[model samples]
Target: MSAFPQPAQPSLFGDDGPLRDTREPVLMSLNPVYYDLIWAGEKTYEFRRRFLTGQSVRWYVYLTGPVGRLGAVIDLGPAVVDAPEQIAEIAERTRAGNGASVFEYVRDLDQAFAIPIQRVAEYPGMPLEQLRTELGGFHPPQGYTRLRNHPDLLSICEKVRADSVRREMTVPGH
Candidate 1:
């Protein structure tokens, strides 16, 4: 598994009480949410390639906006994002208004669907600095489990994730 430089916070989902467990953040990544962020980029093709390489990233359940195609950064290496159509689809079927969004599904998906890792987040909009701040001194909460048990849960397929990102960040690119 590739560990990110920034420590990730456990995603929280609901108010304290019985309904709380269901509000956890769904752990997702480049493998699934990749294409959409690229589509929203000013340099879509270039961004797409970098993301495929590994530069952009999104934390487990942080809020990422794609207002009218204005994609926000979630995954920073190649930057990953969830698209509108993807969100709309879920909203339509579940009447949940955002079932297609990872944010939406995160709160409602059956526990069986918890792949990668799932954590209860305080909010989907938790900022990166905030996550770092909150998690900086956190000890695992009661009855909580972590997915880092098996190292093989993630494997970086190639050097692209970083190589591609550097290509774009250089002064020449601008």
Candidate 2:
């Protein structure tokens, strides 16, 4: 028998109440081109304006395209909101994508925001079907969303956290 017991199936609601877990998860969909850049550690800043809440939070990066998959999780730093020119300068200095491109994208917006990322984990591609199963029916967010009230996602996060702890505890020579 396995040492780790199977995780219990997640219900629509938890024992405490309607899922009100504080740890928030944002599901972000990115085009494969940018996703590849970020995944390769070439791009450090995810530029945004409308979708960003200026909060330092963890994000689940999902690659959307012909190859749709949940590929990585990142601890995003607090959003740095500034003028378009400054934002472009930051992007040019620290990121892989073109600064002019980023400037053009956010020039019309009130303020441009840069969410710096530190990759905590890189997960093998989980297909949309599997993600739907894990998330209890998922929709690709056009911008960003806080999965604060999602019971299924919260449960999955618990399992993932537990598994991560186990992996970290395992002795290399054992």
- Each prediction's TM-score against the native? 0.20, 0.69
Q: Candidate 1: count the clashes.
A: 24
Residue-level lDDT tens digits of model 2 in 89-169: 888887545788999989988788887775446555467888788766877778876656666664554444433321111
lDDT of 1 by residue, 1-174 (tens): 667675544446544445433322113323224333333332122111111222222333223333112012222233233343433343344333334443443343222121111111121233334434544632212222222432221111111122222112211111
RMSD of each: 19.1, 10.4
Candidate 1 is scored at a TM of: 0.20
**In candidate 2, where is summed lDDT lowest over 10 consecutive residues?**
165-174
**Whose lDDT is greatest here?**
2
Q: Which stretches of candidate 1 lie over 4 Å from their true place?
A: 1-34, 41-73, 76-147, 157-160, 166-174
| Model 2 regions more than 4 Å off | 1-23, 51-54, 134-136, 157-174
The TM-score leader among the candidates is 2
> In model 1, what lDDT does residue 50 have?
13
lDDT of each: 0.27, 0.67
